[model samples]
Target chain A: MKNIWTIAKREYDNYFASPLAYVIAAGLLFLLGGIFLIILQGSIQQAIFGGGTPVDIGFINQWFYYLLLWTVPALTMRLISDENRTGTLELLLTAPVRDFELVIGKWLGSFLYILSVIGVSFIFAIVANYLAEPGIDQVKMMSSYLGLILIAGALLALGTGISALFNNQIAAFFVTLALFIVLWLLIGIPASFFPSNPAIGDVFRYLQIGNHYESTFNAGVLYLSDVIYFLSLIAIGLFTGVTAVDSRRWR
Target chain B: MIRVTDLTKDYGPRRALHSLSFEARQGEIIGFLGPNGAGKTTTMRILTGYMPPTSGEAIVAGYNVMEESIEVRKRVGYLPETVPLYNEMVVQDFLKFMAELRHIPNPEESVADALNMVGMTERAKGYIGNLSKGMRQRIGLAQALIHRPEVLILDEPSIGLDPGQVVELRKIIREIGRERTVLLSTHILSEAQQICDRVIIINKGKIVVEDTPENLQARLVGGERVVLRVRGDAAELSAKIEQVKGVQRLKSNPDGSLEFEYLPGHDVRPEVAKIITNGGYEMLEMKTLSLSLEDIFLELTKEQVVTPKKKRRL
Candidate 1:
């Protein structure tokens, strides 16, 4: 635990020390702000009896949750891959710290960075509340943010695990992107192809990250099952990363 | 306080190290000499517990590398061939990180001492990317030393350094060796000769020779070979010198000289002089060839190659 905290502090400090982390944070916030502005404009159009609904604001924020799935990989691709490429992995492996400590430290560091970006995007929620009199559902807004954070956390862990498999950052990013795409898009294919067996469809829907994320985001409900699913993904990702490091020693 | 016994590592049938064994006592500096791809780095990695050997065992500072890796890691400091550093981190920050990783209780003092030891105190606040290669190398050494480990394993620590930087690095290594066991790998023969208490030359996944540099040099004194520049019928003198007792072999040089490899403890200079004077050959110059580390290395490895081939067939 002590080693984990030490590694975490260093990893966290690195995000602020290097331009890469700041660039990622700034780019994410900019995109989030732009999306929020578009949603706010649509909300105004609906209020003035034009062509949209107030619920469109909720739908736009849901899209922000999906945006996080893609953006989180960019922040995580270099966490372990760059370390391996630069040979610093050898130094870290030889240190007295355990493998799990290193993995947890990197995961927490990227998580905190993502959290800060999500925090900045919350400014848009405040802006939307001030620009109108109908007001936003504070509970729903917080729940959506919570859902986004959980999804991002899970994706960052998966990205970190992928990064540990290769020394090239681009390869890590693309491989992770491909995996997430397959899991997200192909979740419906199994259900459609095996419709005669409804159990398979039920399992596929449960496996779909988008399904679980939207369930929490749309209803403003933090289901224990949803929380467990994302937490399990994070655990699996970090465990796989630790195993990768351990296997390299024997390889 | 390091001992490796029957250590073998195979990377999918391509063996990197084969039954390699050596020992380093406390306060001894052992030089690991090998060519590129000769398993120097692999052996160092195993010693440092960065990687595990496929077979056999190693004990470092009273801890087994595979069984007690964490304990071993705590007792050993390692600087790999490439100075692995976080380029974005400042020197002090990186050292502190390393200290923490090594589980140093007093990280502040450890970082300061490491920086001071490597003469990197002034550049402690400078980013590693902005530092020169030498400075980065020093920082790497500092990271390794931050925990004050009992045994230090360095793989080509002086590689990629200018002559001046190499000297300074060697000086630091020598100073570090005074109180700890140091197992350093390098292909530079002179570097090993200058600093090593003992040298182990590894070739083709095996140790070809192991001895003190002076002892190894002394063993290469093959009965004194003499190069003589003479103004005479060199071919005839070569033929005549071959007939002299204790003269093992004689060859005539293109420059009208006769070179002789005499038997052990025999000085055939008088015989050569007598032959030249009586046969009307002018002995312009005669010089004894001194064997260098290169010659010793070649001789040892050459013998090693022939013996191994026979053993493999057997």
Candidate 2:
């Protein structure tokens, strides 16, 4: 446990020391802020003319969650791959730290950093409350934020796992981004392709990350099953990462 | 504090270590003398718990490397051939991280001690990436010593250092070896001769010979060989040198220099020079040739190549 914290601290400090983390945080916030303004403008248009329902500002997270496909990969691509390239993997593996500790520590460091970047989007919620009619729904906003954090955890864990398989940062980044894209598009598979088997479509929908958030957390409905789904993904990703690191000893 | 028995490692189809076995007691500096691809790094990795052997066992500081890896890792300080380091970290922070990884109770004190030991106290605040190669190597050593492990495994520790830095590093290693078991690998013959109490010569993943540097030279070359260049006729000089005690098998080289082999523990240079001068011949040059690691490789390879061919022909 102490080993995990020590490794995590080093990895966390490393993130802040490099320009990559700052670029990621700044770029992500800027893009999200632009999208937030557009949504706010559209909501005001509806309030003035169409007489639509009051805009739930927290729903902006629905759009922001997709950005993780880029942010998570950028943050995690160097976690283990950079260690391998620098030969620091040998130092860490030869130390008294366990393989799982190293994996979890790296994932936690990136997870915390990305969470802070996501935290800045709270400004959107505040802006929404000030301009909207009845103010933002606090329960829905918190649930949506929780959903985003969980999914980010799942994606970051998977990205960290993939990072362990390659020594090249570019390769790690592309492979992880490609895998996340596939997961994002899984829900888009046409029903005509799998005619006669609706179960396949259901399975794809269940696996699609967006479905869980759009249905449960975004709608202010917190389901135990959805929480389990993200947690299971986290477990699988972390397990594969630990195994990849341990396999180095045999090779 | 380190013992290996039949330790073998096969990287896919190629065997890196062929049942290699050796041991190091406390307060001993053992040098692993081998050329590149001679399984020196492979052996050190296994001993440090970075890699597991394909077969056999290794015990480091009273812990089984494979079975109790954490315990072994806690007691072993390894510096790999390339001196792996975090270039972005400050020297003091890096050492403190290493100390924390080793679970030291007092990291600040340990880091300070390690910095002082390697004479890197002044560079503690400097970034590792900004440091020169020699200073980076010193930081590498400092991190290894942060935990004050009972055993130290260094692979080609002085491979890229300047001459002055190499000398300083060797002095630090010698001081450390006074209290702990140190196993360092090097291809340089003189490094082993100067720093190691015992040298193990490995070739193609197998142990060729293991002994003190002096004993190996005496046993392999049979004695020291000396060459003398004179300004006069070689015939008279050779005859007089053969008469000196312990000089055996004197031969005249094509360059007109007299060569002779003398038994170990004998100093025949002064006597031979005296004879050359007394015979009205000015000695132009005289030097003793020590047995180099290359010579040992040649001697071993000759046997390996010949026996295999003879068997194939039969």
Candidate 3:
């Protein structure tokens, strides 16, 4: 356990040393800034031109979640694949550390990096709270943040698992991005194909990450099922990654 | 200390190691000398518990490598063929990280001691990317030594190093061997000759020879021989040389020289010289014959020429 933390710390430091971490943070912040500005502009236009009600203007809070579907690949791409490309996998394997420690350390490191990106996204949240007229729904806002964390954890876990299976970082990035997209919109493909089939739609909705996020967590109606789905996704993804790292012994 | 008995490894039917066995007693630097793909790395990997052998057993520091791999890993330090380092880390930081990974108590002191051993205390804060290749290799050695392991396994530690660095690295390895058993692999025969207490020559994944460098060098040429260049008739010199005591065989060369193969524990050159002087032959040159390790290495690993299959005419 001590070795695992040490590995995680080293991995985190490696990320800090690289510009990619800063780039990912800056990109997420910039995307949220744009979203924050649009929400502020809409609020201003409603106050000046129409004196409209702001109760339904909940679009800005969810834009960042949508953006997360794309930006996460950059953060998790190099987790294990870079180790493979750099031949450091050999060094890590030969060390006294076990397979689980290495996999967990890498996953934890990427998770922390994702947290930093989310931390940057908080800047917009802070600004919107101060500036919005009717004010952001703190409950909905809290749950959305929780939802984002769950989604980020799930995406990072899946990304780390896929990263372990590839030697090339680019391939890891694309495969993870595609998988996240599939999970995020999993129900769409099945629903469009079997529009009238209620059972298939229910099954696809259950499998779709968006169903748990957009309907319950994103809408601030946090459900036990939503928590279980994301947690299970995280657990299953990490297990797959651990298995991949363990298989390296035979390879 | 490390011991292996009939270790065999196969990768999808292609055997990487073939029943290889060797031992390194405490404080002995046993050099693993072999050409590329001779399973030197594979054997070291197995001993270090990087992977288990398909058959047989390996014991390192009194722990079975297959059963007590964690303990074996804790006691043995390994440097792989390529010194894989996190290039983003500073030297001191990397060593400290490795010490912590090895679960060494008092990481600061171990890191300091390892850096001091490699003479890198001054450059501890320097980035690994900025360091020279030789320096990085030393840093790799430091990480291996950080935990004060009982046995050190270095695979081609001096490869790609300059001649001066190779000598310096060998000296470091020799110093390391004084306290811990060192099993290092290298294709450089001279390095082994100069550094190892005993050398194991592996060829085609088999132990071709295992002995001290001096003995291997001596065994090839057998007993002793001298190359004597003389200006004389071949028959007269041959007749007198055959009469010399302890002289085993004589072969006359086209350059009017004689190669004398004498019995072991004897030097009949003086008697033969006297015989030549009495025969009124002027001695142009006389030199003792000693085969180098290179000669023996080539002799052991020399491949047999295989005839090509004939083309069938349709």
Candidate 4:
């Protein structure tokens, strides 16, 4: 555990020492802030005209979760790949740290950084409380934030795992981005397309992470099964990372 | 502190280490002398627990490298051929990070001590990327020593350094080897002779010879050579020199010089000098040549190459 923390602290400091973390955070905040302004204007206009329900800025939480599919890979792509490129992987391998500890530490470092970026987006929620009627739904907002954190954890783990398999940061980035995009697009496949084999379509839907996020966590409902689903994904991703790193010795 | 038995490593069909074996006791400096692609780095990596051998047993600091890797790692300090350092990190912070990884009790003091040991205390705050190659190599050495392990494995530790740095680095290594076992590899034979208490010369993944530097020199050099240059026709001088009692072989050079080889204890220079002066040719130079470490290395490896070829012909 101490070894894991030592690695995690160094990795976290590394993220901030470079411009990658700041660039991604600033870019996401700028784009999300624009969306928040549009939602705020729509809510004000609706309140004056009394045409429809008030727009809660909390609705933008889905965008935050979805954007992570793209940004998480960018955050985690250099975790192990850069180490391999710089030959530091050998140093780390020869250190008195376990493979699992290294992988978990790297993922945890990115998770903390992404969490902070998500935390900064809370300004949008505070703005909604003052600018919109039927402002932010506190319970629902909390659940949405929880969902975003869980999704970020899962994506970062998967990205770290993919990063371990590659020596080039660009290769790790594109592969992880492609995998995450495919997982996200799985939600669009309709069960009706598989009339004879509905179970296959059902399995696909069950595998799509958004299905659980949208149905349970996004609606302010807490379910152990949904939490377990994300945790299982995290476990699988970390296991893959550990295996890839350990294979270096054999090679 | 280090022991290996029948270590073998194969990358696909190419064998890297072919059942090679050696040992190093505590407080001794062992130099692994080999040419390129001779598996020196492979052996060091295996000893440091960075990788496992295909078929072998290695016990480092009383722990099996394959089974108790973490234990081995805790007791070993390894400096690879290419120093692995984080470019963006400050030297002190990088050392501190390594100290933390080693789980040192006081990272601050350890980092300072390491920096001082490598004479990089003033550059501790400088970023590693901005440092010169020599400075970076020193930093690499400092990080390896931060943990103060029982054994140190350095691979070509003086590859790119200037002459001054090489001397200083060798001095530091010799000091470190006083209480800890140090195993270093180099292609430079003189380096092995200067620093190694015992040198193991390997070629083609096999041990060619292993002995003290002086012993290897005394064993391989069976005869003495002398070069005599005179202001006269070399063909005439060669014929006279060959007639000397102890002269085994003589060859004339293009530069009006004759080289004479004789038994180890024989002094043929006086006889050759008499012959040269009797011909009324002014003797310009006469000097005996001593065999260098280079000749010993070539003789040993050359013999190995010949034996393999002869076996293949059969």
> Candidates' interface RMSDs, in order?
0.9, 0.7, 1.3, 0.8
TM-score between candidate 4 chain A and the true chain A = 0.91
* Error at A138, model 2, angstroms: 1.2
Over the full model, what C-alpha lDDT does candidate 4 score relative to the true structure?
Answer: 0.86
Q: RMSD in Å for candidate 2, one decimal?
A: 5.4
Error of 1 at B97 (Å): 1.1
Superposed Cα deviation of residue B271, candidate 1 (Å): 2.7
Per-residue lDDT of model 3, residues B198-251, tens digit only: 999997778988999888877765766678887868777888788878887687
TM-score of each: 0.91, 0.88, 0.88, 0.92
Clashing pairs in 2: none
In candidate 3, what are the lDDT values of residues A75-151, reduced to their tens digit?
A: 77788888888878877777777888888888888888777777766666666665655556677777888888898
- Local distance difference test, candidate 3: 0.81
Question: Model 1 segments beyond 4 Å from truth?
Answer: A38-61, A126-134, B248-256, B262-265, B303-314
DockQ of each: 0.80, 0.80, 0.67, 0.78
* CA RMSD of each candidate after superposition: 4.7, 5.4, 5.5, 4.5
> What docking class should model 3 receive?
medium
Q: What share of the true interface contacts does candidate 1 keep?
A: 0.86
Stretches off by above 4 angstroms in model 2 are A42-54, A130-133, B228-260, B264-314
Query: iRMS of candidate 2, one decimal?
Result: 0.7
